[model samples]
Target chain A: MKSLLKKKCHRAGLIVVFAIAVFLGPAHGYAKAETAEAKSECITCHTDVKKLIRLGWKIEKTRPKPGKSAETAGKG
Target chain B: MEPYEKIYVKPSFLKTNHGKIGCEVCHNGDTKDPDWQTAHKGIIKDPTFPDADKTCGECHEDITSTAKNSLHYTLAPFGGVIKARANKKDKRVFEKVCQAKEKHCSACHSSCGQCHVSRPDYVAGGFLAGHLFQEKPCMDTTCASCHGGRVYAEFTGANDEYPADVHHDKEEMTCMDCHTGKEMHADATGVASRFDLPERPRCEKCHPDVVSKKPKTSSHAIHRNKVACQVCHAVANKNCFNCHAGTDKKGLPYFKSNETRMLFKIGLNPNKTKDRPYNYVVLRHPPADPRLFDFYIKDGLSDFNKLPTWKLDTPHNIQRITPQNKTCNNCHGNVSLFLQKNDVTDWEQKANAGVVVPQAKIPKPLKEISPKWKP
Candidate 1:
């Protein structure tokens, strides 16, 4: 019980610090940087779809049952 | 998902109009650092949530303003039902229950980005298509991701015992074909249930001729206003049992439910109206129980009997030849097919009293019948 309470407190502390950081004002970044090109390095590392699927990024191709016991479907 | 999939951005997205806005504007994160956590210190994970009046709202003001109240975004109807059953007299306990509702139930609610850009957070969100803004969210991927447990699964005939809905099998009609963009993006000002919406999807909306004065079939003439279409057409509909909610050791919430499939039941119409004048309707037991909020506050829903347990349902497994349509005797004399008084326990007996069909109320079998309704 004490350990669970401590973990909750630790999470609460992090949330408070994060909230303060947000209130302090915008940090140094390209929030309003204008360029001829969008210049997104985000796509640099995130475009590999096949790897994501292999790593369990569920992109269900077919309609699969939500659970095991749900049945082949009803007596339709 | 791998860390990359959670943050996957398509190269093609960067070329689109939305992508041209740059991630910094929407995310409000640092571009100087490459460290994922450090750079995303103050990131707005979903800029189009709660209300998108600032980011995407700059471009699409009208939709962003109204979509906030959409059932997909708010899921407020769930709360409405809870509130109806709750003992609002105890303000302190009621307030605590509301927080529990937010922690567990509302955790699965959606936003624009979750639909068009990525999977829902509850499903361990990842980009849907390299962050490319889709005009229509994929039926299987986006819609089914949330509704997979019931509607999407039953409609497409994922249930091995039942064939697919006639519309899905014959006409290849998808959810968007009937649901429409207008209803989904509608202004839900004072709506508690989907049926409360003025422009909800109706079977009559598409099949007008079947409801004509001089109907082609005798079955339609007899049961048109008296019975719901699902009473005759729906296959074994899925019915869920007691669902309980609790927080794990890590303080994240989850739900556990017991359900049964291929069970078709008929009961008194819970919510009848001019649009749906059916006296008898299909009833599906939603996985809601009094102990659902016990994890937060014991017996929070003190007045649980305020609403019926077996609520009205429009099951998706519509077929041309349902067991009920086999003959009049298939439904009339089959007391087992109806939701009887003994189906529910004594505690739930009060909650489901209106829906449970009495032994005397079950219809008697006729001598002859025909499968006349083909439309």
Candidate 2:
């Protein structure tokens, strides 16, 4: 009787584990896929903004007097 | 200052409905190409501009349609001022000046994408929260990005001379709390100035009892419609001086402010409408010089004197107790507090003829401005 009861309890524990995995497994996979998608092909390098501005990136580069002040103004 | 990070897309944003719609839906780039250059080919970068009706309007038709005429998008008032300032007599010069205005001034204007999707182009456009189509774009990033120079700076006590506006300092209120979506979208007000907007913020809107009825405070009763609120409430704030507009070597628009300094002055109201019926109002200098667009065409702003350089101003820096409210003499008979003839620049004197107060016009110090209350 004890052995039969033990076998039933073990079977119940297995079912619970399988149920938890069944619930969480797809969610885990979905999260990973979403993360992968987040690293978009667009962001794989070359920003549309950077390419447009790369030729004359004055604000961050030379920091012209007005640019410097405007930047400092924002610091306020 | 990684430029790439400015345009970075976050993982969280990818999970949003907008991101789920995919890039090609709005951006329309060739995603199949492995090379970034090739992939970016045939891309409709920022399809929201000049034709948001086709892109954003597809889903947000009502908003996009009405927003086309909004102050933010058209920047019509500023454009009007630009056009008004130009030499309208010479058609060729006017066209050249307008083209220059387009190159320089137009960049400062807002678009649907600039506000809703990304940071403003004025601040060098970047993705906001990894390009989330935020219902209300973050205030600090979007609105403050443009108004940061004066309005936001003063409101937040970023100026060392001034304290934060009570709303910001105490309540921690962001701009949208008062500005609202209707204000941002600016529903079809057939008016030029924001001051003329019917839905413009009124102090009475929040503090009705303070001004609506005969209040216990005698001063409130005395100054009901005579003095503007900012005259008594606002502290010293920055006023931008000559803003000369020009283009860089690459023909990118830029402006240089010769000076921006803290000032507080009261002047006669320039445009006293029904909403702002006050006879006296706080006047602050805006960045205007008759020669603003001179770089493009000689005397481009030949008609600059049509509008006052020192316009009616409502400074964002508000306080309950300011120096002006301390005593009757602090404002009344305070010649220095008012915009005197000397205060106006030599060239701007003509423009500000209506704004400059004469000695005779100054109000006498009242013996009893407030009988009931000390404050």
Fraction of true contacts kept, per model? 0.18, 0.05
- lDDT of each structure? 0.77, 0.78
DockQ metric, candidate 1: 0.08
Clashes of each: 4, 0
Could you give candidate 1's fraction of true interface contacts? 0.18
Worst 10 residues of 1 chain A by lDDT: A67-76
lDDT measured at residue A54 in model 2 versus the true structure, 0 to 100? 68
Score residue B47 of candidate 1 by CA lDDT. 84
lDDT of 2 by residue, B1-375 (tens): 356556666656656776666677778886556665577788875778866898888888988887887888777787788777778999988998888878767777788989888888777777776677878888788888889878988889999968999999998988888888877776544677878776667788888866866666777877888889898899987888887776666545567777777899899998777778888998878878777677787887789898888878889989989998888888888888999999987888888899899899899877754354643
Worst 10 residues of 2 chain B by lDDT: B366-375
lDDT for predicted candidate 1 compared with the true structure:
0.77
Candidate 2 pairs with clashing backbones: none
TM-score of chain B of each: 0.94, 0.94
